[model samples]
Target: MPMPDMNLLIALDALLEEGSVVGAARRMHLSPAAMSRTLTRIREALGDPVLVRAGRGLVPTPRALALQAQVRSLVEQANEVFQARDEVDMSLLERRFNVRSNDVFFGAFGGQLVDTLRVHAPLSTLRFAPEGEGDDDALREGRIDLHVTSRRNFGPEIKVQLLFYTRFVALAREDHPIFDAPITPESFVRYDHVSVSRRGRAHGPIDLALEALGLSRRVALTTPNFHSAIFSTASSNLIVSLPETVLWGMRELGLRMRPFVIPLDFEPVQVVQAWHPRCDKDPAHRWLRQTVKQICATVEERNAGVWPQP
Candidate 1:
């Protein structure tokens, strides 16, 4: 017996992906007839007609359709493996990275992230994505490069690491009457509040703490993200709740972030960096994670008063 032509795998993979001789030709910059000949070779190797004519277009046969995703992933991983890091001059690495985070994330830490990256990778760009109801599908599909979030029970396949710990604080503008007087639960409850929760959550540690003492704040405005609450509180009298480590320089920008004692103590929030395990050993991906952590450290230093810097 003789060894098979393994080089045909690439062509087979392309043909399976495109399902059309013309499409594979366009992708590989070959004429349709040449691509057809290449497909004939692929069929000889695979022992199957991968792309069978179906109606006006070609469709993959049973074996080819089953092999589609696996082949694509394998070829992609192989390509990356061969394209190892050479002299990576950050200034020359031009790319747009998408990040999935909520309003509080961008308002609090995004500035530091941008500043840090710009000082080194000046050619890079950022796309801040919107937070939705549940798992970030963008991360799975490679649409998002980084995910800044708190620790939550996602599936085991997802990888995560702790970045920092943050504590909650209530925010009110400078010269707000609450700051001038005693902040009892009753006093706090009397004021209307602006708040955020991804699930449209009606309550939190603050609400629980207040309930323990038989009191509650009137949450006049409810939004899906911390950023939404921040912008709303900037001009209104509504009190905003936030994690101090993330919300930077808000007071100087005319939003006073102040500390208030909830009736009961609650745990400090843990800031985490999460990504698909597929990026585990990637050098550039690791570099991005480290850079983000460094920026978090710098921002945490400024928020030391709110919580002990981690």
Candidate 2:
């Protein structure tokens, strides 16, 4: 057997993308006659009428439709491979990045991130989606550009960088009864609590730690995000345990909330930003990762221990 013409793959991509002989020819800077001959070669090699005549326009066949995304990915990767590493012009970039994150992250750095992008990559658009919206392989399949989260359930091949480490702190109104006395394990469990779990799980390391001490707290409410839990604490006696970073600006946001050290042993949360390995070398994606990392570092440093220790 002989190797197939690799150039035909490019022609096939163009033809499928344009869906017209004249359009593909214009895109590739080729004559319509030459583009038609190339399409014929592509059809012969693939054994399919990749594009069929529809009344005044061309429509992709089922096979072409199925292969459209894969072919586009291949072409893009090939282009990235050949492009210069330092060739990215941020001002001219017109790409959209899909970032999946929880509310805690958005509360911490969303505004700063948007400002940085507007000044640097003005043509780029950042779409921040809530958690649990995409499939398991959303990052791998290129549906999501970045995952700024604490969860580490991604595949081993995914590139991950620790953005920062934050420990859990119980947040409540500054004048709540829990703060009237020393916050001990006994006093901590006396008040109702608000739990933040996307899965609606009310118990976690805090509960287990309390269990080990022969004590457990009642979770009166369970919310899916930290923002809701934080807000719920503002007007109620509910004590909510959240990452220290999430409550950084509670006072400035006019929430009148304060964080106290939980009287229990717990590990620090490793907030990380993850991406597919295919984007490891892509300049724009790399910039996004770096920008996020920088923003996290800046916020952590500026607001280090924003709330007073109780």
Candidate 3:
């Protein structure tokens, strides 16, 4: 088989992303005719009419939409392979990095991560995006530099580093009557609870464990994040099943928690920092990973005794 022109991949990536041959031409500094010819070649090489006219605008076929992200990632990785930077030069590095994570992580370690980055990369800006709808697509498109989540099932190709493991615990106001004594499953199920998740998921691993034991709790309220759940607990008798790490800001967030005496042995939640494997050897991205890993280690160290001391 003859080697296809790799330049076509780069052009197709830009063309499909821009959705306009003229735009892609301007981006690549190529003439419209040259880019159109390149697009024709990409169509032949890929054996698809990748882009087509829709009214007055160019639109991608389903094939082009599917290939857009994959092609861009491949092009970016190929560029890195040919000119990969071996070392990070922080003093002169000026870049903006976007990290996708939940509010729990921001409340716990975003400050420390920002502090560390400020000291070294003076010109670097860090942005945090919440786990909104379609956020994973942002990561796939290279808009998000890093993603931190306890949720697994991110595709196998996403490069992942274990940051830490977190487990769910029951929480309420410090002076709540429940904390005066050992918390039994019966007692836990008696109290009203708050549901937490970006989608306001009313059930979780706790519910499953309870179901196994023929128990269930009343969900009094549903909120999107841990901060809201904890804050709500501070004013109401409503209990919350939250990750142990969210307790880190209890003194600051004004919430407290105690373990159930009839504790269910639930799966440990592994929090990981994930990125596209295309970023694995990129120096700037490597620095970002190390920086985040250090932040996670600091959080773990600072809250050492908080997790179930066993």
lDDT of 3 by residue, 155-203 (tens): 7678888998876777777677787767778788888999997786799
Lowest summed-lDDT stretch of 10 residues in model 3? 253-262
Error of 3 at 262 (Å): 8.2
Candidate 2 ranges beyond 4 A from true positions: 1-73, 81-84
Model 3 regions lying over 4 Å from their true place: 1-6, 29-49, 55-57, 132-141, 253-263, 304-310
The order of the candidates by lDDT, greatest first, is 2, 3, 1
Cα lDDT for residue 80, candidate 3: 78
Instruction: Please report, as a residue range, the 10-residue window in candidate 1 with the lowest summed lDDT.
Output: 255-264
Q: What is the TM-score of each candidate against the true structure?
A: 0.74, 0.78, 0.82
The candidate maximizing lDDT is: 2
For each candidate, what is the lDDT?
Answer: 0.73, 0.88, 0.82
Q: Rank the candidate models, highest TM-score first.
A: 3, 2, 1
Considering every candidate listed, which one attains the maximal TM-score? 3
Clash total of candidate 2 = 0
Model 1 misplacement above 4 A: 1-72, 85-87, 255-263, 304-310
- lDDT per residue for candidate 1 within 80-115, as digits (tens), equals 788766446777778777778776677777877788
